[model samples]
Target: MSENLGTMTDFSPDDSVMLKDVLRGLALPQKNIPSLYFYDQRGSELFDAITELPEYYPTRTEIGILERHGAEMAAALGPGVRLIELGSGSALKTELLLGRLEDPAAYVPVEISREHLLAAAARIAADFPDLEVMPVTADFTEPFDLPEPARRRVERNVAFFPGSTIGNFPRGMAADLLAATCREVGAGGAMLIGVDLVKDRATLERAYNDAAGVTAQFNLNLLVRLNRELGADFDVAAFRHQAVWDEDAARIEMRLVSTRAQRVQVAGRPFEFAAGEVLVTEYSHKYTPAVFRSLAEGAGFRVARTWTDPEGLFSVQLLEVPGAAQDSSGGT
Candidate 1:
């Protein structure tokens, strides 16, 4: 095993409290749950499969963005950056990034799953032997403290939030992530975030609702998680997968609608949803070039550079901290 950065860390109570608040939105009675919890080990493996599916274009498209801009992008980060990755699942996209970084201090992969986090950190460390690998097992949506030595050595914390995961959150949480990362990494550093761009709803819907049924399995897996962890009796098979594009909202929404009205027991409590009641599983908010930059600016990030794929399916934008100065079109 590659050595951890002389320090290993876990989430603090603050982190736990914040995560519960964000995730508890599921109980709202009108909406479905967020698919974030689908990342627990098995779900992570399923996602790895989902990335390889023919319909899932975001991963490969985002990879293309990195490949085209990787070296230039790395140079743009300035020298000797301590790269921190949020939701660092498998670190597949990030391996492309590490190729471009001019090694400085350490690499911190912050993942809620300790297993995935350590496995990825270990693999990356083997490749970048000189770069210290610090893995923090904690939820990225919540506040977390980095490993002791990792925190001490961080000169500039460059966070790589790939996978367009920002779309999963509502606008408020998205804003909070931007602000929180800025506060955590503090001023001067930058955040390279992957965002899915506004595209034809047909294309968007197909990507999430693949013919191979991997996305469906992934969506349904959340119910399995809730059942196991929360003691809920979710007859997951009784749900139908639905993907609808909300054009006005500029996002693709995934839902699990009940096939029949049924009462389900969760955490020793029972609740009923009428047939056709939708459980919103995920929302993939697609952004235009302008709206995206405005969002970062709203949350204290100065937009630096935006890289997109040749087909315009996805975007990887770099935002500077303490906010970026504005030009007529928005941050540069």
Candidate 2:
């Protein structure tokens, strides 16, 4: 067991930057906020609770796929691989893959929430004493340096992005992010990602609009974050959470609708909201296998393999860079 806990890159946005982004989003025609803001301590906790709700099936389903096929997935990446996970919330599914990997070089968990990332990283280090745990506190969508393992030599970097979080980005942005990840991992590297599949409208809507209202709290917590962090005077109670399935977009849209006309002040700036005006919070896009393959191909990755549950409601895909030199000893 190595004592090297690994290094952290603190690229977290400052309060001023957050305020600027919040103000900019509020000024948009759609009046949107970045979904990343929903990960404050309370918001993160709320989301963890939402995952346990019966209506939310993605988490459990994805976990089942990882549990059942993690060994195969690990074998695909092979030995001496560096695993970098994006948006590693609690890293609950990560253990399944990490435990199965053969002589993995290191584990890097990238997250925007510093507190959450540190906690998860610490736990992983304590549990996997032989594995180097490098945690980066940054928005994974942005560029950040992958930490070098102090004790081990890695063959290639394999990004482990689970939880269908890639759906949070719009198609174009998602493709761009995938391209960026491909570049970061280099030519021989690969990525293992979880993607939610397009399902019936009822199931999609129910997932976001959980009966327990925990999802609602998770959505509204964005406003709570704005009020607390940016000194925004938002009438949080005056807004209602709404999740709708957009057939044309093949996505679930989460919004906060103002119940009545209201004025809110943030950073001493006033913003007016009409009674029915909506503030877009997030978008979760579901895709068919062909659609996801096309998206990854456009981003410079070839779809190597895909694993899905019996119902095909979600998919865990293995994406690899093409025409790269192979390590003969590594898993194929």
Question: Residue pairs in steric clash, candidate 2?
Answer: none
Q: Which segments of candidate 1 are over 4 A away from where they belong?
A: 4-7, 12-27, 148-153, 322-332
Model 1 over residues 81-119: C-alpha lDDT tens digits? 777888889999888888777755667788876677777
Where's the lowest-lDDT run of ten residues in candidate 2?
A: 323-332
Q: Clashes in candidate 1: how many?
A: 2
Q: TM-scores for all candidates?
A: 0.90, 0.96
User: Each model's C-alpha lDDT?
Assistant: 0.77, 0.89
Q: Write out the backbone clash pairs for model 1.
A: 32-280, 302-324
Give residue 58's error in model 2 in angstroms: 0.3
**lDDT value, candidate 2, whole model:** 0.89
Q: Write one digit per residue (lDDT tens) for candidate 2, span 100-157.
A: 9999999888888888888889889998999999888888887777777877788878
Worst 10 residues of 1 by lDDT: 323-332
Top candidate (lDDT): 2
